[model samples]
Target: MPVRNALEALTMRPTRFLLSSWPWRSLAYLTGGALIGITTIFAVLFLLAAGVVLSVLVIGVAGYLATVLSGVAVGRLERWRMRLVDRDELPNPHRHPGAPGLRAWLMCRLREQATWRELGYTMISALMLCWMDAAVVYAAAVVPTMLLFGPVYLYGETSLWIMIPVAACTPVALAVAAYPVTAWAGARAAMARALLAPRSDDSDAKLVELSRSRARLVDAFEVERRRIERDLHDGAQQRLVALSMQLGLARLELADGSPAATQVTAAQQLAKETLAELRELIRGVHPKVLTDRGLAAAVGDVAGHAPVPVDLDLRLTGRLPDAVEVTAYFVVVEALANVAKHSEATRAAVSAGVRGGRLHLDVRDDGRGGADPERGTGLTGLADRVAAVDGTVALSSPPGGPTLLHVEIPCAS
Candidate 1:
């Protein structure tokens, strides 16, 4: 297996590990940590001193604030430097400020748990961990090199036998040093990751925002559908009704059994059919009954039009959220349409109620049940629509019997 980090490199065969670059990377990591830690100590001391000296002035507050925020910069730099020993990327735990000003940014940072965690890590790294890192590097590299040069360092002071043995053991000592260096580096990176990594609450917040965004889009689309439905119902449907009346009157004025009378009669019939089709199209766009009444009435209107016999068992009390109602209504409509087209069932049933702060819906059919969502049926669309409101779809279909589609949408009635 390939080694992806210092800790994983420890699992390799001894010879293979010694030949790899992990030891050098580990050395670099420790060296960088030592340097950063020493610098942080001095920087923090300077800030503290300045804040004390300027305590009587407004600039002292700036110094104090800078000291508090210093960990943010250290955290960012350390996360980047961690790449030497840990190949995985560390996400910034801090969130973007809602406002653009520096004051807003500072307030936001101060209010976050991650900010304090970073500050604590910063202090620990400077006071303890960095010193340990420096010691590890010194013992691993400097001591081994000194022992390897034993002959040169002790040419006349020590016996030839002692020097020879000491120099001969240099390679073994250096190989052993790699283990401690890599181990310490890996441990330090793990500690840093635990302190600076993004929290679970941050992920939850993002998911909530994403859900709200999808709901907003669904609401916008519903509004457009209502607008189009209104246009068809009030504009084109009215014109068609007037044109049908004019054609009827013209047909009465023509000579009996004449071509003009026949043409007018046919035009009147065509206008009437067109008007009926337009009304259905308007309902499909957005049913007015859904707005005027509630989900129960809207669903009843749809179930009444289903080709197969539909049994409704709705038990909703008042009204649900507009999005929930719209989504539930469409789910029933699509399920019945699927029953008519694919289920081949003579009878279907729809039951809905609000339970435990959730709107529950079950559409079942006693059809030859082998419905496949992958068959380009409307089931996928049904699932997508429910998902827009963070709802769930559950389907049960066996090869020889009944099929059931269960949906749940969250709402406050």
Candidate 2:
């Protein structure tokens, strides 16, 4: 095993572990921690004494405030020192102050959970952790040094045979001491990491901002879709409809069996077909019904159009947020399209309702059920769409029959 850290170094063969620099590094880390811990105890006591002695003055408040904020400095120093025994970098959990000023920065630090956690760790380090570290280093390093020099100091007081044997065992004792020193250092580093690092439950500012940015992007896309749909419906489709009507009148005026009549009739047919295609394209871009009516009506329209017989059980009593409605509507559209194209089943069902401020939707088919999202089904795109609104997707498809796709989207309207 490679010696990435003190803990990993412990897995090496005994000779390799003793020869490596990890033992020395661990000793240095513990020594530094012990020194810092002693300094912290005196500093905190001095601040408290100053605060109490000058309690009548505003200057006294500064002392008490600094005592509370002491952890900010300690946390930064400890993170830097942790590199000696742990190869991994420890991240600073504090967020930068949103505004610039000493007061702003202090307020930000005071508001953070990590700041208080660091304070608690600093107290533990001063009162207990650092003492334990000192004890381990003293036992490991100090005891070996005394044994190695014992023969010279006690030569006349003790028998030569006993002194010689004790001195000879010094090398073995020192080598054995390395394991306990490194082990304790690794454990201390782990504790610092757990206390000072940001976790999933820590309400990280960056994570919250990322989610807000994603929702904004989804809203921007929806707006663009409506713009394109409007342009096609009001611009190109209207022009095509006019062209078809003109061609129809031209055919009527031409001679019954004339070449001009035949050409006009063909042009009219082509124009009508093109207008139909454009209308469908506009619907796919952004359904007018979805914007005018609510999700229930939109879903009912989609169910009526699915090739496979679709039974709709919509229990929605009111409208949902636009993002939630759009996301849920598309999920149903894509799911039913998959059923019509892939599922051999003759019937499918769509159900939706609003409960606990979330919109739940389900699409099911009695097909030759083995739907795999990894196989480039539209399910992957569907999931990405739902996730934009902080929604979830669940699929259950067995090999023999029946496939069910369930979706839940938060609709806090």
Candidate 3:
């Protein structure tokens, strides 16, 4: 019964309607504005005082250190206050890079824009908090009292003006109810703006630079692949073809069955082995199976080879771009390889599906697991490969439990 009521409250239309009304909404907005003003003022003043004390403690040398510390402290405090008032998650504080020497450190600290801005916000917040606290008290208490008492004092009659106090008390009472809600919402918005919003034009510039870098990397990779293909075809392939011809000639000469014929047979066998090795190397460079069969068939081949039992649940119909397919196939192959090599689990499940126009892949193993990114080079390589294609890879493996790898790659429509 209690659960049903709670669920109904979650979907209560009338409650939402009342909250969304103009008068109530306005009161909520005003209250939130007041709380932000108050909090910011308080933060600013506190930072200023702390800065002064630090300056006095270290004098010239300590002043720089103090400023840097003050900035970090202020940023964290503001974020904490935001969480308390607004229930918003904020980004972690940015750390200043450590300099080689004391002078370098001091210079770097002084040069940071965040330090000055945080200090300024702290000073401003202190004054604002004090003023806003007073305003909120007046709005919540004095305004209602005055409205309730004003009419009786002015008219000396409680008949017609009796309703005046009630009318006046209405807004004030609403304001009182709105105070906390306003503070919470405003704090969330301000915190998001301050902590999550890009602080400078450089962030946008960096993104542009990153996109250009990715394009260049892909172009370079294609050029390198062409060069490798040419090398393999002209150098290794030609040598292997000549070797095969030599082996055939040797086999024909070995038909006599003399001691020299036995030597010829050995040479032919060696040549055949060399040719086979060359073919395997070329396949490793870029498998034709991956291109001809698509990601599904390639991944299924990988699953079939796994030492552990693998349940593949793939629903891919058409082909993705060559680059995307190769990347997806390799990601699965590497994940399953890890499962087979590291995960001592009895069974594993691999699933692939398209969701939100992106190819999603998941591999799970029920094994004794403690997979850490820092400990493995295979996972790191896989991560870089996925990132090259603008994909994301996530791994979760707790000690003595199941390990799961999730990957998502954007597909061109």
Candidate 4:
């Protein structure tokens, strides 16, 4: 009963229903069949024109705008048709508004190749619709008429002979065969509409640009590090060594004399100051602890000094490549610094573990959290650092809550 009722409902509105009983329901099939054949031919022609025209224009902005608009138009038409004939709800296309002022908008439009292509598709759709309308009428009329009249003609011609019966059966067979062809046409039209739609090319270009910029920055950082190391080794390191030798000689000379003792004490003080400065400079270049003791030891040194209570769970066992270890250490250091400064949370957690051939680090704090990547230069630098090594960084901090900073770096690389 329900199946029959459903079939009846489908037939009642031929314009909206896709499946229905034979004869009375054939109109919907005829309309869809016509649309399919016409739209296919039109879409191919439009796409070809778009490709050729865009090549000639070569004006990126104008081409882009035209392509986008055309895509939108085609997509809207497809959705409208789907809703009316197929009773399917499709996603609406999103259109982004261009910059203000006519010149700016025009410039943007000219650059876009996709817009022109879309426009080409729209023109094709119009032509296809006209052809489809004609085809549907022809198919609907001829098939049903043949079914009804073929039997009468057969009887008249052969006078109930065996061949008459065979000829009478042909019309029904033809009508039945048309159903599948109609469905196929409807599906093909939907697909063509989707293929001709506009999409953003800027996102892909922007991502590539970002990756290259980050790589350049990382290379610059390495160069600066080497420069600093050379400065410490050649300039300050040599000066400190000379100073230490002078202090030793002064101490030997002043072993008994009071005036000599005072000179010795002053020399010792100067040497101590120089050594401290040299250690600080070396640490800035690259922490010796990181190279010698590994990331775990370096992180431990960071946690010990952090203003807030830091719970560290570092489980990385084997030594990673120098670059990876350095990056991982800094990510934690920066995250912890942020937690201490901003995250008003009383407690923070730092964890580093190697899993699935990748290094995963997480720093979380329970504080009055409102961490913004855009506002903070530290976080931005951290992002660049991670990105330099083809790694990823994620930050989650909402107002009046905890903040979580997650970093992942490939160990093999």
- Total clashing pairs for each candidate: 0, 0, 13, 26
Give the range where candidate 2 is weakest over 10 consecutive residues by summed lDDT.
198-207
Q: Which has the higher TM-score value, candidate number 1 or candidate number 2?
A: 1
TM-score of each: 0.86, 0.79, 0.47, 0.44
RMSD for all candidates, in order, please.
3.2, 4.2, 16.8, 16.3
| N/CA/C clash count, model 1 | 0
Q: How do the candidates rank by TM-score, highest first?
A: 1, 2, 3, 4
lDDT for 162 (candidate 3) = 66
In angstroms, what RMSD does candidate 4 have relative to the true structure? 16.3
What lDDT does each candidate get? 0.91, 0.89, 0.65, 0.67
lDDT of 4 by residue, 1-413 (tens): 23222223433444344344433333454465356446655564565566667767664444445444554555556556544334336543342334688777555644655556545555555566546545656765676566656676666566556555666766555555445434434544455446544355645544666777776776678667767877787788778888888877777776566887887778778887888888766765777688688999998988887899999899978798777888888888778878877777798989999899889999999998788877873999999888788999988888987888889998884
TM-score-wise, the better of 1 and 4 is: 1
Tens-digit lDDT track for model 1 on 1-413? 56678999999999999999999999999999999999999999999989989988868888888899999999999999999998889987777777999889999899878888889999999999999999999899787798888799899998999999999899999999999999999999999998899888776766776777797899899999989998898999999999999998888799989988988898999999999999888878888999889999999999999999899999988988989998999999889999999988999999999999999999999999999999988999999999998899999999876999999999964
* Global Cα lDDT for candidate 2: 0.89
Which parts of model 2 are misplaced by more than 4 Å? 1-5, 45-59, 88-91, 95-104, 138-170, 197-217, 231-278
Model 1, position 43: C-alpha lDDT score: 97
Give the runs in model 3 whose Cα sits over 4 Å from its true position. Answer: 1-198, 230-235, 238-242, 255-257, 304-309, 345-349
Q: Write the per-residue lDDT of candidate 3 for residues 312-371, one digit (tens) a residue.
A: 999998898776787787787778878888888899999998878899999999998899
